[model samples]
Target: MAGPTILSSPSPPSEEAGTILLETERLIIRRYFLSDAPAMAETGNDTLVTANLRAGFPSPYRLSDAEAFLSTACKPDGTAYPQHNGIFVKPLTADNPSPEPRFIGAVGIIPKGDVYFRTWELGYWLGSASWGKGYATEAIGPFVRWCFDTWPGLNRIEGEAYGSNEASQKVMKKCGFIEEGTRRGAAEKLGVLKDVVNFGLLRSDLEGVKELVRDS
Candidate 1:
């Protein structure tokens, strides 16, 4: 008899502790929670946002999907196996605080094993309302650096941006990811054949980048 088809497991969190909130000068990248589900669903369900992404995200996203995602990404032990983080803008002042942190987007690093075990696949998305602010660039750079710093064995990180996604390609470029090449018809989105541009950053390339300092 054939064995059951099982989903692959994510890599364990490294011995070096992971942070709940990674602060850059302008943004905070943190873990997703059930509380953020409504915002997440709203951001993801936008036609403008979903147009560039894979087909799995339904047009009218449900709260149940968000809950499932939060549970999967954040386990009960408080350790995120696959390492998904939410992007939020920092408030301008210490005294005057925003009621809720604006949900700019989410990013993740998926580790693969093979000849490519040392490589992780990177993916991200930004809400339509958050466009044009350079938040994507700011948030991704530190996240990439943190990933390499935490996992010494990781040599390369790669991502694919659909040809039409100039904003995402710009983020990749700003974060020091070099354009490797293009894969023809690598994905199908919204009934259209999309060409994806491949980008990668090596550990050596990230060596000169400064490590992010934790905020109190």
Candidate 2:
């Protein structure tokens, strides 16, 4: 595989303000915490999880690597900061008012400033063990809803999945994103060029989706 891109921008400053944690019937989407480093390392270090991602994410991810990621993700005013929500399964709730959340995966909104700051790209990854459980679909829908409600200036949310990643494409479709087109050799994964299928969901599209979900 090709070497990872080195980030040119300075890292964001740390902040104590916590991000909003959203709960679905089966998952809890929340901000990263210091205590989650070990779990993050365990999940992210898996080769299956990192293979689809950009080259920078190291294999055999260490605790220190997880700490650095948490710092970057929690930065106060950074564009690439805490916008990534860690996905977790909802534990038994009968004994508690709320379910105990366990880390499983992550989803994020990556803003493209050149696109008028009104467009954000969506990215997600789940643990190999967590695959095929519809968690991606369940988590992504609410995250998009929360994004639109939280960021009024957002006009569009876009995503691109490798052609071979049918499951990811399905998740985007289920979350109301429409296929825009395809880009051949858009990315290189594991030393080979990969085709990518683009998907997008506009603000108006989200409105229709919201209505349908409400009626159901």
Candidate 3:
């Protein structure tokens, strides 16, 4: 059960290549880089990881898949797509010190338009090896706050999990997302129909929430 000493950052760090969006005790959530394709492919190529994620994530994820995703997340000149990020394992210890940030997962929001312009959808996925460490729970809170702070017009953020994904549901609960309802048989994954459970957090829900660190 190794961990980092600093559990929260009032101000997140920044770098030229990737802007550090948020930091927690053991994770660094930042914009993805094209070079991350290899690591992304390696870590995301698990059936379990893809099973819990959206249909877009391919099983046996290859370098090509990772490349396409990176291409979509950022432009050739390195400008980020604005909301996607890679979740890296922060190396805060000297023994395991490595200059490179270890890519472990990702988190992002899909902007809604038209009548739902003020709303957004939240999604995240971690490598199977990184599961059960509370990293998802730790990262989501501040990320949500950052979203509210970054977009003043943003009123609500929505998260949906397959009914079978209890772990994801728990993470949403821990992050102050209120369970809205279940959309029965709304999604089909791997040829099986699954209920989608909806959860939401409004800007008003952030009244007492704190500890969001954004780069200047």
Q: What is the C-alpha lDDT of each candidate?
A: 0.73, 0.74, 0.77
Per TM-score, what order, best first?
Answer: 3, 2, 1
Model 1: CA > 4 A from native: 1-21, 76-82, 92-97, 207-216
lDDT of 1 at 130: 83
Candidate 2 structure quality by residue, lDDT tens digits, 29-86: 7777767788888888898888777777777678898888887676555343336668
Per-residue C-alpha lDDT of model 1 across residues 16-130, encoded as one tens digit per residue: 3223546787777777766778878878778898887777767666788877787666654333334677887766545217765667788887766656777889988898888
- True lDDT of residue 146, candidate 3: 74
Report residue 124 deviation for candidate 3 (angstroms): 0.4
Cα RMSD of predicted structure 1: 5.2
Which residue pairs clash within candidate 3?
none
lDDT of 1: 0.73
Residue 3 of model 3 has an lDDT of 31
State model 2's lDDT: 0.74
Query: How should the candidates be ordered by lDDT, best one leading?
Result: 3, 2, 1
lDDT of 1 at 59: 69
What tens-digit string does per-residue lDDT give for candidate 3 at 1-216? 533222122333342447777677677888878898999999999999899887778887999999998886765332122367898877744412777778888898876766786788999998888888777887788788877776566789999999999999988877878899999999999999999999999988777444332211
Lowest lDDT 10-residue stretch of candidate 1: 207-216
Please identify model 3 stretches exceeding 4 Å from their true place. 1-17, 76-81, 94-96, 208-216
